[model samples]
Target: MILSPYLILLIPVLYLIGWIYWFLKHKRPSLNMPRIISFHKISNTPELGGTFNTVKQFESFIRFLKMNGYKTARIDKILAEPEEKEILIFFDDAYENIYNEAFPIMKECGLTGVLCPVAGYIGKKNLWDRGLKRFRHMNENQLKEMSEAGFEIISHSMSHSDMRRLNKESLIKETTESKRTLENLLNKKIDYFIYPFGLYNENVKNAVKNAGYRAAFASYNEKNDKIDSFAIGRNTMYIIDSKFDLKIILERKPLFLFGHEDQKGRIINWFSRFSAVIKI
Candidate 1:
């Protein structure tokens, strides 16, 4: 077998051509849907996951919404209202950065976000994920401050465990008990559920609905074509996402353009099944 050094270069060129062809030939659709973007952490420091949106990225996102005339909806997230341009920024895991970093940035933009806190891990370091990322969940007082200031507080389950395999009793504890914990802590009715690690099934959805939540959101597992209240999908923002990627998503470009990132997230979710026995 004879190989030319130029062959290696030609392979990349071909891939580049294919990528360009695929990107341009596809028609990008501006979806008339609710803008529900999800974020995990707010920091420039690197972590084991791709979910961090640097402080600058967070501020830019809020500013982009404000400059584009996007308003933060104050009602229950997509429960009663028909789809509109109203943006609902969702901060999953309720990292303290949401309070120390993202809260003021959003407040300055005259916007607020939906904060999903793991009820059991409030004020404690996240022990749910497979690693000790040392990420701290917001404390009770911080959560109350945001709630009082108009941020929606909801449950990311009780312990941030993988709930898809739980029995009815344990699932109820994860569902209803978490909601009750949040409501009791915030002194407000917790109206929605954000599944832990965005992992859920029909039984999991049933657990959420049976818990009396109006809707349940699963992160990074949705397409705009169908919006399910119980299985609503959220677009997750990552540190590696380019500014152009953010622009296309905000403009509602076709999901295929940047949706591979989401598929990666789903793969991460599957690996979380080992969180109980491993620490990576």
Candidate 2:
């Protein structure tokens, strides 16, 4: 095939146009500080969960965080003053594989993470993900072992139900009961809560706060000029994500990171004003 001279000349022009678009789109006067991130199921298998990352990938990702000098979530991670390059890592759905697979890697990397588990389902299979694969939660003994190893254990919920779909009574039960159960089992204060499926509303956030949690995690760090600890949003890690994706997220310099979602995100933002009941 003969290359056309006109096409060759247009290549650099197109590249410049793409670069300019990205530069403007990702330009932020200030970045979101003290990063908060979430991950789940550090396994080699993909069928376990959508965010299931391979063990090798997990190790590499943690190493990158450590290289950048990101701090692990200590007891006062939320209340303390933000250190240089601050970050908090959260692991959801307390799969036993995390204890077996991720714990050692974290220890080797000299890092830690908060593990969120369904309080009522400790030592039992994840009934919520029963349709995927039969994965067990870390038993009480395992939970204690990880705690002794210096990993924080927090409440996911009683049964991992969507908080937005629950009534006020049910929402309270889910948040408060789970915290009570974990505290009783671990014999320590459970300070944080992560909403299941990344679903929440003002009511749900109020319930989490009333339940004695210092903070709660939801999915996607949308624009929150005033950061509310109760509904603190997080970016979900998927099996397909790369080192570049991790870099953009941790640095809070999203250039080409979310470029594919630009169109869809704009459409949603356009209708957001009209949808009084829907909260992003």
Q: Which candidate tops lDDT?
A: 1
Best by TM-score: 1
Runs with alpha carbons beyond 4 Å of true place in candidate 1: 1-30, 75-79, 82-84, 130-133, 221-223, 254-278
TM-score of each: 0.82, 0.78
Q: Which lDDT values do the candidates have, in the order given?
A: 0.75, 0.72
Native-referenced Cα lDDT, model 1: 0.75
Q: Candidate 2, which ten residues in sequence have the lowest lDDT sum? A: 271-280
lDDT of 1 by residue, 1-280 (tens): 7889899789878766754554454323336445678888898766665567789887887787788787888646444573666778888889998899999888888888889999999999977554435789899999999998999988888887778878989999999899888888888998889887777889999988888998888765354455677877666777767666666666654555454444444555454444533654
Q: Model 2: how large is the Cα RMSD against the reference? A: 6.7
Every candidate's CA RMSD: 4.5, 6.7
Over 4 Å off, model 2: 1-32, 78-80, 130-132, 254-280
Q: What's the CA error at residue 221 for candidate 1, in Å?
A: 4.7
